[model samples]
Target: MSVVKPLPNYLVQRYRGWKATTYDNNKAWYRHLSNEGQHPRAMIISCCDSRVHVTAIFGADSGEFFIHRNIANLVPPYEPDGGRHGTSAAVEYAVTALKVAHIVVVGHSSCGGVKGCHDMCSGHAPALEEPTSFVGRWMDVLRPGYERVKDIEDEAERVRALEYEAVKTSIDNLMTFPFVKESVESDLLTLHGLWNNIAEGALEQLDPKTGSFVPV
Candidate 1:
């Protein structure tokens, strides 16, 4: 059963509709941006989940945000991987090359990648790294977050804390870059921690004043 053999009906309909208006309506912005390089206002580090749409969440249009999506919205510690760190490269370009003022790390609830990492905390994750088995190694990045919140009173609270912990961890990881650190210190660049709760129709921002997530 190959989906590639026959295109899905809904996808074909969407493609037809979007293709009709996209060129006519979006041409002006595309033409303008072609002459002038992309000057996005913010750099968004977000999840690759289809539901976690960075542009739609902010109601952003073309070139508004330099977006980078990765599994679990995780930012591995800054290290050279022979050539480039894809997410880090975007952060470097957005900070140094593009000079974006804000960089936001967006996380979400019921994320499978996050859930997989959380399950590793329960000692269910295996030690072996078989073919296509990076979950063990990848979840290692979030082991400390589980250690930090293993004592929460409620099951729901425990998950909530893990989700929140993931956000802060990425923020901590973002600061590993000297340019980002200096910008944060000088107020040249601002970092934001956001958790998008699609089910609740709510967006939560980590408020330093209350030291908790509050509705934004």
Candidate 2:
């Protein structure tokens, strides 16, 4: 017998209700999506924070965007070494197989992973520095971003700057992938960096010319 148990009755019931209502409201759209498969124009890499709600922010529908969510929305530098790189794998698939026209890296305010990196790098969260800590290891991707803002005198401004840096860092790393770079050079793919303010409901886009984040 399988070790897994059925989902909690309340959650399952809620899903069933949604499925019924959605099917009744848009049966043909769902069927077409199943038959045609996804052809999303953009691939969005965002944080796994529940409060971010990317679809709602973009007003996107089911087949509009190919989204990948991970801690702090980080993308590690391209490494072709034979290792399990989940984020890299997703990027390769989106670029090579999907041929998406745009790739967006989205960072947000009050990101726990970014905060953890700040704390760990500043010597406040020693546990995150332990070798066996998965968060610590994963957050190594954001250490460079932390370094960029480590010297800021104000704590709040420092963290906010790092959050924006995290988005820029991921965009930089995305270009390290050969396929992504080639696509951009050929004018087939455009890379974008976005930072979202959760509490204020604000968005900022990176200005490539000036290398700064400006309100969107």
Candidate 3:
């Protein structure tokens, strides 16, 4: 027997409300989208943190962006070893298939994954170091980023620096893919790194020229 359960009452109510209002009001537009298919302009790689609302951040409507969310928003270096790579697969489809013009790696403040990476790298979280921990293996992608910010004396500042490094590191890893590199060199695609201050509602974008993050 299956153990699946239905949605909670609140979510059911919310869905009904949206179906009755928003969906009803935009029936034609929704039908048009269904018929025409999605043609998003950019691909956004963002952290899985619930607080980071990718669409709301840019006030983007449906089908405006191809978004992928993962822990710490870290992208591993291109490894054609034939392993199960969800993030890489998404990138491949977005770039080679969808042909998105831009790819953005977004990191944010108060990221639990980033914090776990920091803790594990600092030898403060032993459980994450275990071989059985999936999160530990996933966070290994950010080890380089942690190395860059490990020496910072202040704990808060160090974590924040690591967050920014996470974005930069992911962008670097993204360029490792042959298609990504080709698209970038040919000027067919652009790469961007962004860091969001969750509490302050502020965003900082990486300035490639200076290799620094500045207000967007």
Query: Top model by lDDT, which number?
Result: 3
- Global lDDT of each candidate: 0.82, 0.94, 0.95
| Model 3 C-alpha lDDT per residue in residues 1-216, reported as the tens digit of each score | 478988899999999999999899989988888999988999999999999998999999878999999999989999999899999999999999999999999999999999999999999999999999999999999999999989999999999999999999999999999999999999999999999999999999999999889999
Model 2 spans with C-alpha error above 4 angstroms: 1-3
Worst 10 residues of 2 by lDDT: 18-27
After the best TM-score superposition of candidate 2, give how far the Cα of residue 103 lies from its true spot, in angstroms.
Answer: 0.6
Residue pairs of candidate 2 with colliding backbone atoms:
none
Q: How far is candidate 2 from the true structure (C-alpha RMSD, Å)?
A: 1.1
Candidate 3 C-alpha error for residue 161, in Å: 0.5
Best candidate (score: TM-score): 3
What pairs collide in candidate 3? none
What would the C-alpha RMSD of candidate 1 be, to one decimal place?
3.0
Where model 3 places Cα greater than 4 Å from the true spot, the runs are: none
If ranked by TM-score, best first, what sequence of candidates would result? 3, 2, 1
On residues 1-216, what C-alpha lDDT tens digit does candidate 1 reach at each position?
A: 554577789999998898689856888888999999999889898888889987887889888999898877877788866855677788888999999999898989887777777767776555423345776666566778888988887867777788888888888888888889999899999999999997876899988777678889
Writing each residue's lDDT as its tens digit, candidate 2 over 1-216 gives 598998999999999998889777988998999999889999999999999999999999889999999999999999999999999999999999999999999999999999999999999999999999999999999899888889999999999999998998999999899999999999999999999999999999999999999999
lDDT of 3 at 118: 97
RMSD of each: 3.0, 1.1, 0.9
